[model samples]
Structures are given as C-alpha cells and as structure tokens.
Target: MIYKALGGDGAAATVVTAAGDARPGPAVELHDPLELLVPDTEDDYRLTVDPDTGHLGFTSTTEAPYAILKADPYLGARRKQTIPDPAFVVAHHGGPAILERTASVLGCDHRQLRHSWDSLRSQGNMTSVSVLDVLARTLDDPDGPRPGEEGLMLAIGPGVTVEAARLRRT
Candidate 1:
C-alpha cells in the first residue's frame, strides 16, 4: 500500500497514481497484511530524490536514524517538493522492458533508472513502490491523450520501487 505525498499534503486517498497492479492489491490505507508486517513506530522523517544523480535518501526531523533523514537534502529538492507528472515519458511494453523504453522516452539512464526503482524497495520499507506515477499524472490524460502519445509508465515491484515523473529541462 504505497502512499503518495500529495504536494506535501498528507497522503490523500483520491489523487491518481501511475502505478499499476499490486499482487492482492489492497485499497489505499487498507491494512490487511498487518498480521505479517511489523508496525511502524511514530517518527518524523524526510527523503528527497535527485533525478540528476539518481540519489534517493531520507532524513528524520525527530530522532537518530530519523535525523539523518532530516539532514539537509542539499543537492536536490526537499522531500516535500512534489515532482510533477511526466510531461514527456512514454509507457514501455512491459516488465523490465519498461525501464529502457521509459529512459529512452525521457532520456534518463536505463540502468540507473532500474537501480532507482529497486532502491525504493530496498532502502525504505515501502509496501509497493511506484516507478512511473509522476510522469503519467503529468503527461497523459488518463482519459486519453493526443494521438501517438502514451501516458507515463508505472511499474511496481517487491522492494520500494522507483516512482518518478518526467520533466522537460526548462
């Protein structure tokens, strides 16, 4: 049950996601696997992503492991800054295939993007990571977009997955 950090607004259940299927996907905020997953303790934390370098990290606003997360996200936007939906990325065919296809579409590193995707799951305990949600929301008109254009791509895997949006260098 991965959650969207809505414009730094608390997780909103309604905002659309670029993510696709979740095995036995649970509704947002629904906790059916509580019996198997450990509960999280309350703590303030911040994580920011640097698309330029593929750096994913976190900082805590409150305590130990947390403070590290809270440490300045010097090189990139702060955790609360919302990366927009993809105005350029395209949806690839399927599986890992999407990685290279999307990178080609957005001009990002395919392998680095793949690592970023895997990092989401390995680093944080996100239930399911969203790799292409931001792009879809920004670029495609879910209802349908211009001809020859596909919405942003989304892929979710076991570990926190790479969830990113495409942006044109302005």
Candidate 2:
C-alpha cells in the first residue's frame, strides 16, 4: 500500500521495514475536556488534557520546538537505520506545525513537507491512513521526489509505538 502510494511504478522501488515493537502501555490517559468522566474512587489514573490548544496552541510557538529538540536522538537513530541520506520523509500527519518541526529536525525543505500538509488540509486527519494519504499526494505531484532518491516512512501509534521503513525510489 505504501509503495503504491509513493508512486512505485512496479518496476523497482523497495520498502524495507526497520523496527516494530509495542510499548508496555501509556502511564497516563488522555482525556477530552468536553467528554464527561465518571467519578471513580477505586482507580487512580492520571488523565492528561488534550494537547490540542486550538488557535492558541503552543505547537506554533514553544512546544513544537522543544519537542523537536527532545526528539533529536530518536531522529538520529532512525537515520542510522541503514538508509543513508534519504531525500524524502513521509510521516504520520499530526498537524502542520508538528510536521514542520519534524521536517526541520530532519533537514527536509518546505516543499518536501508540503504534501503531508496538503493531505491534512484537503482531507483532515485520516488517522492510520494519513501517512499513506500524504504519500499518495507526493506521488501524484509531478515535481515530487523522484527515482534514485531514498526516503523514510514513519508513523506513531497508540502505546507511543512507531513504525518506520526505508525506501528507495525506483
């Protein structure tokens, strides 16, 4: 699905899975403020507020930069996974700010990150399908990254698990 989405002509492109592992579980539960919570005296669970702060979100300002800084090691590790000098990066579409921050940390240009934002803007968040959607858009673009270029594909899911792959355009 990802290969086809990324304009694999069925002639050459290759997708190689990197690491796949599930974390134990989240120590905290994220809650929506608008949702009512039943009062529970038995269980002690920390309910974290949704990070989405709407128009006044910290993503555009402080949080994203801090996150990028904190994620440097992880990014470096991903880069070290045998895929050298990837020219493109396809990540799960969180939001424009987060995507921009990720691209900045990855040393990707605005044009490379635009397809993910385009997918977000045009179709909203498609959850698990978001990265594929972005890949489809990238493949559809005439001026998108081309053959011989290497790329990295990544997605973060529940349990703070990440799925990543290395690809070489054919």
Candidate 3:
C-alpha cells in the first residue's frame, strides 16, 4: 500500500510514513488506514493521461500528483500508503467530503474508484482474491469551499482512480 499527506492546521508539520508486506499472504487487518492503496497487478484496469490535455500521470508505486494538487490549496503536498488492496484506495488526511469532491480535482467520477478496482482483476490480469480496506481523507475549511471541502481522497494510479480516505478538517 501507499500513503501521502500534506500537513494541515497551519502548525509546524511533522512527517510520517510506512508500508505493508506484499508477499503472498492472508489479508491483513492492516494498521494502515486501508484507504491509501495502489494496484498490485495490471490490466485489471487502464490508465489515461494526456499531458497535452493537462491530464496528470501517476504510478501505483508513486504518489498521485493530481491528488496532491487537489488538496494543496487547503492543505499542501500530502500523501501516504500501506499494503495492497484489491479495490479502492483508502486515504484519511483530515473525511467523506474529500471523496465527494474528488471528481472536481481528479477530473473523474466516484465510479472511477470501482473502475480502478475492476480494472485490476480483469482476465489476462492478475487475480484479486479478497478486499480488506478502501477509503480516503483530506482537509477542507468549513467557510472556504464554495460547495464544501472535497472530503475523502481520490487518486489515479496505474489502474483506475483509486479512492482513498474519508477526510475532515480541524
């Protein structure tokens, strides 16, 4: 799994991170948030990025810059992760609103989350056994957003959009 986060609350930020073992094993009740995930296989889905059209590119092992960019205004460059999950990218920087607003930033829809998961398990692709976690988080000022802070997190990795977190702001 992978995780990323930008320090919010305007305090002197501290950095933290960790990863889960990927060797074939039983699904973990992973200490990780379960939301911040990246695909462990391929062809389960597809990745579309057109730089000429301003689409951002992201890898399963790398932080999704578009996700970082989305929360940068309210938070900043933030990310993290843990072991792998079959479907969904769990994230928790600050709650659900972030997930809700993901379409605005990532230029995709919530369905993209499922699409990502399905993409990872298609034929000719590696088989996905079970799913343990799927969530995301972020920060949004109550008085800041026109609609509201985009809660939860949404990222595009090598597969479909990985939905991470169930965000909130303090």
TM-score of each: 0.20, 0.55, 0.23
Over 1-170, each residue of candidate 3 has an lDDT whose tens digit, in order, gives 11112111122222222324333322222232222333333443334466688653323422333343434333222332221222223222112343344434444455544433433333111112111122211111123212222333334333433434433221
**Runs with alpha carbons beyond 4 Å of true place in candidate 2:** 1-70
lDDT tens digits by residue: candidate 2, 1-170:
32223222313232433224323321111111111122321122121234574321111223322344345566666566545566776776666666776776677777767778787788765655787777766666678667666777765433233456665555
TM-score of 3: 0.23
lDDT of 1 by residue, 1-170 (tens): 02233223222133434445423322221111111111131233334566898755443332322221222231024212432233233222223443444454344454324433453334332222233332233333334334333223333221212232322221
Give the winner by TM-score.
2
lDDT score for residue 42 of model 3: 43
RMSD of 3: 17.6
User: lDDT for model 1, on a 0 to 1 scale?
Assistant: 0.31
Which candidate do you rate higher for lDDT, 1 or 2? Answer: 2
Q: Model 2: what TM-score? A: 0.55
Q: Is candidate 2 or candidate 3 better by TM-score?
A: 2
What does candidate 1 score on TM?
A: 0.20
